[model samples]
Target: MKSTEPVCQYELKAARDAMEVIQGKWRIPIVISLTYGTKRFGEIHRDIPDISPKMLSQELKALEENKLITRTLHDSMPVTVEYALTPLGMSLRELLDELRNWGKHFRGEIVGK
Candidate 1:
């Protein structure tokens, strides 16, 4: 007999987990910034001036924990750390791009400005 489920429970769980990782005010912006290339903490903070250091740190930690990004530390004179998107995170670029196109279409239809 066929189970006839739209999606497996594990697939649903994966979807929910992905959402949780990216579901935050600053998370998407942070991810988008890293999509281009690696960035240092100060660079990210400067790019997002509205986000407090504490909040940005929290989001970076969460993203790192979820394997969406990787943090590398260099043993230079003062020690340097940079963040780059993981393969999983980079996979979101296409999806986000599609969303951006959809948003533009919707805005044009509704706002018509």
Candidate 2:
């Protein structure tokens, strides 16, 4: 794991593909928010501060198109829509957790927190 070398071509392509799918600033946060279970549009916006309605709508559509999350329209009195992670998106949970841990460690090392 400590090899200081470039990744193989296949691994490079795979990492690039993942970066393409989860490229934008809001995508990962959006996915993280959904990890807590399904939530409505407003709830997601509220959970992630500073994301505009338009951007959230656009990202949600992109995530759905990428098959990471599902958008369900519930037939209730007022018609509610909820977003939930598909198995593919849930697959990122461990990776995200690892990233979080690394971020904390890096911050502590660099900032002396």
| Highest lDDT against the true fold, candidate | 2
Residue range 1-113, candidate 2, lDDT tens digits = 68788769998899899889989799999999999989999999989979989999999999999999999999998999999999999999987898789999999999994
For candidate 1, lDDT tens digit of each residue in 8-100? Answer: 889899989767777978998899889778999999988889999999999999999988899999999899999999999898898778867
What TM-score does candidate 2 get on C-alpha atoms? 0.90
Candidate 2 residue runs with Cα over 4 Å from true position? 1-7
lDDT: worst 10-residue window of model 1: 1-10
Model 1 earns a TM-score of: 0.80
Clashing pairs in 1: none
Name the 10 consecutive residues with the lowest summed lDDT in model 2: 1-10
| Candidate maximizing TM-score | 2
TM-score of every prediction relative to native: 0.80, 0.90
Q: Against the true structure, what is every candidate's RMSD?
A: 4.5, 2.8
Indicate the residue-level lDDT of 16 in model 2: 94
Candidate 1: Cα lDDT at 88: 91
